[model samples]
Each structure stands twice: as structure tokens, then as C-alpha cells.
Target: MSIEYGEAQLLPGEKIAITTDTATEPFWKKAKERKLTACRCASCGHFRMPPTPYCPECQSREMSWPDLPGTATVFSFAICTRSPYSGEPLIYVPVVVDLDGAPGARLVSNLIGIKAEDVEIGMKVTVDWNPIQDDWLLPIFRPV
Candidate 1:
């Protein structure tokens, strides 16, 4: 993938730092096992699909991993064709998906298995998981 920036860039498969959150650690651990886990606020009874320690709605610390709807809609997207570094263009579409059963909750991921030009802002999409390493399984998205 190419970055729109003209200066130096980072490439895929290159080492990078991923900030982890205590609330989301369980989600990641479950992702390592190829399961999509989300968080739900026990107090408010609202689900946070991406997982978080405190509920953004009520600021309650009573959170737990609950089964997600495993469905989403594309709230926004961008057609990306430039890689961070110079090489064969790895075209990808970046999108923010609003999770079902959790209004206003969204997560960002690459839109794969479809042409970038065909992406739309309000398109229907779904979650996808790909294991890149022994311990890292990334969550991606695709058209439904």
C-alpha cells in the first residue's frame, strides 16, 4: 500500500507499535483464537463491539466480553492506492463501520476482497479475520 504522503513512509509487514488497552486485551486474546469478542457495559446494558474498559455512554467500569452481532455498516471510507513506501501499489480501502446492536459504535479496518472504486459511504459490510502471525489475528472488513 502506498501512502499519499510524499516523504518517507512505513510499509506493511514492517515492524510497528500497536497500542493496547487494558479493556481491549481480552478482545485481542480472543482474536488470537479467531473469535470476535466485544464489550458490553453491565450497568447500562449496552454493548460496545470493539471492546473498552468503560462505557463511553455511561462511563461505567462494569464491562465484560459479550458476543458481538458480527455485523456492521460502512459509515465512511476512502479509496487508498498509495503505499507508504515506493513499490507495487497495494490498493486498499479504509473504512469506519458502525457495529450492529451498538448504535454510534464503530471500528476502523481495511475493506478487502473488493475494488476500491466500488466502495461507498453507506455500504453494508461485515467483519473478517486474518491470521498474520502465530499470535496476531487481525480483524478486517468486506462487502456483504
Candidate 2:
């Protein structure tokens, strides 16, 4: 039998912090405004996450940011039973998701609003934001 995990991994008073740079800042900026975007190759129209400066497809620095559908498919996941920080008992699901409207781009984020046992590969989910440090937002997902 599997142990029960709570709906949230971050305890009541905890917050998440993040750091962003030039290449990745656009995505984070959009996220802070409650919008979801993926980096696209302006020339070849390919999508990539963790946004890089040049397109791997056509060797171009031109890129575009387009809002996504805010939905995703659970490509893979893992169930955690302990907090990496506190070493206390906690349960949260870490997932790699295939983003809608962004072909070939996958994002690593957390899954919330569902029990651990119910999370399945290929499950449909939608984006939900959690506040993080410096007034930023995090994109967690819920069942769609």
C-alpha cells in the first residue's frame, strides 16, 4: 500500500524562490502576469523550454513568445513522500508535461489538486498558479 500524500508539498508558511536570466526571463515574465508562454523559433517555428538564445533547428537567434492553451498531458511523473528541504513527511507529485500548443516542448512542474495515486501517464491537466518569492507565480497543474 502507498502512503497518503497531502495536496501540497510546500507547507503553509513556505515559499518558493526562483532566478531568471536573459534567455529565460521572457517566459518567467509572462508567468508572473498569469500568462503561459513557450519559446518558439521565429524562423523554423519550433518550440523549446528553458528558453535558449538560438534555435537548434535553423541556427537563428530570432524567436517568438506565444501564449499557450494552459493545458498539458502528463508525460511522466514521480511520487515523493518526503520534503527534500526539511526531510519531513510530505507528498507531492513532480511531473514532466507535454504542453498544449507547444509541440516538442515539455515543462517540469508540480501537480496539485489530486491524490498521488490517481496521477497517471497521459492524464490531462490544466495550469494553476501558486505565488512564489518576489511576487512571482509558479505554474502548477490540476486535473482538466
Candidate 3:
């Protein structure tokens, strides 16, 4: 899905991570960099999306961020032709990407630079990083 925003291609806002100390600051910070990071329990070693201070599995408060594989498929998507941003036609494809290392783990991100008709279900795709910040890289998917 290609979105032509006419000189407004870069994303806005600072990204930060979510933690007990600061709920949602760093979360957007990490996203601004184009990298998807998940919190892992130190005890049970269970991965958690939308990073949390405590582990939902073992109920442990100890967690750490880990780099996950960005490869995934078009589990589901939608073609968005209308947008509130300048009223420009944007093809938005929301994809659920399953990581290579973390089985059953998935994340949602927009797919760009591809045609809406060319997108297919179960199509092989890879992740690309967007360097909006120096500390992180947000993962974006594209066709293989």
C-alpha cells in the first residue's frame, strides 16, 4: 500500500518505551524508530506485546525488551482509500506479522510502497526499519 502525502512522508511524534516508571513514553519512542520490541518475563520467559511491567503469564514484574524477527504474512488487511490527513487517497494495509524466532507472536504495522491489488493473503513479506530516532528503528513490512 502506497501513501503519497506530498512532502509529509515522515511520521510525526517522539517514540518511547512503556514501563511502570512511565506507562507510554518509551513505547512511542521505540515505534518512532521503526523497531518492534516486546517485553519478556525474566522468570517464565514469556513474551508480551505492548510491553508491560509485569508478566501476564507468570505474574512476574521483571521484564526486558528483546529484538524479534520482523518477517510475517498478510494475516489480514484492509484497503483504505480515504483519510482525514489532507484528504489524499492512501492505501493502508494493516498486517499481522509473525516473528521468525517468537512463534505465535505477531504485531500490526502498515505496509507501504505496494499496490492494493497486488497484496494477497498469506503472501511472504519482510520487515524494514524506519530510522526516525537514533536509539530505535520501527519495523515496517514490505513484499519479499
Candidate 4:
């Protein structure tokens, strides 16, 4: 259960682990379906990233999964010129994106479809899916 991405091996079954908790299962399930979902507090109407069992704002145990447009802005980024694992020359930029729908939510992902030097903070981006398997997809962002 391993797939090759460039020179790296991606083992979804081995590398990806989902918790059996009720609060977090939906997020991973929707991601596998190529949809972006965020957890919202039912009591205080607050949204949270890295979904948790209880809401931080109101301490509510009720949560709901809502679909997101997957649009985001580059909050910060770093360009990796060398791979730490393989010691190969790499030109990828990993960005921290501020999601549009969730005000305080930020997602860490790789920026693609453009050169690393061209990336800038506040750049508009949209989500794209890279299929790792029939039931697994990785979320990537590209310049819009």
C-alpha cells in the first residue's frame, strides 16, 4: 500500500492514521472524498481548525461539519531548496493558508502550479486534489 510521488513513497495506510472519535472522523472522511470541511460549534457558532471534540470558545460538545469553498490566502510560506529526507534539490514552497470561510482557521499545505520565487504573502489560492489512491486524496493549493 505504497504510492510514489516524485522520488518519495507515500504509504497512505501506514502513514495516515484517523482517530476513531466521533468529532474527528468526518473531517478525514470528507477529505478522502475530495471535499474540505470544517468543524463548527453548535452552541456558540464558532469555527475551529484541527477539529476537536469540544469547542474551545464555549466548551460545547456539539459540533457540525460544514463544507468549505477551499479558497484561501497565503498567510506565510517557506521555500525548501533541498529535501531533508532524500537530500535532493527541491523547489517547493509550503504555505500556511488563512481559509476564507473560517476566520481564524489556517491550513498548512504545499503551493503548486507556480515557481517558489513567485509566491507572496496574501496571494489568492484555490484547492486542488492530488489522488494518492481511489479512496485517498491529498489537498493542494494553486494560484488563482
Q: Which prediction has the highest TM-score against the true structure? A: 2
Candidate 2 lDDT (Cα, 0 to 1): 0.86
Could you tell me which residue pairs clash in candidate 4? none
User: Which runs in model 3 stand beyond 4 Å of their true positions?
Assistant: 1-36, 131-137
lDDT of 4: 0.75
Instruction: Give the poorly placed runs of model 2, Cα more than 4 Å off.
Output: 1-14
What tens-digit string does per-residue lDDT give for candidate 2 at 1-144?
976654745332245778898888889899988888999999999998879999988888898999999999999999988877778788888899999999999999998888888889999999988887788888888899
The sequence of per-residue lDDT tens digits that candidate 1 reaches over residues 3-117 is 3422221135333235568877887787676666567788987777567667888999997766566778888887656764565565766678887766656887777766666
Of candidate 1, the 10-residue stretch with the lowest lDDT total is 2-11
Instruction: Please provide the root mean square deviation of candidate 2 (C-alpha atoms, Å).
Output: 1.8
User: Which pairs of residues collide in candidate 2?
Assistant: none
Error of 3 at 77 (Å): 1.2
What are the candidates' C-alpha RMSDs?
5.5, 1.8, 5.4, 6.7
Give each model a TM-score: 0.76, 0.92, 0.67, 0.80
The models' CA-based lDDT, in order, is: 0.68, 0.86, 0.60, 0.75
Ranking by lDDT: 2, 4, 1, 3
- How do all the candidates rank in terms of TM-score, highest first? 2, 4, 1, 3
Highest lDDT model number: 2
In Å, residue 67's CA in model 1 sits off its true spot by 1.3
Model 3 has an lDDT value of: 0.60
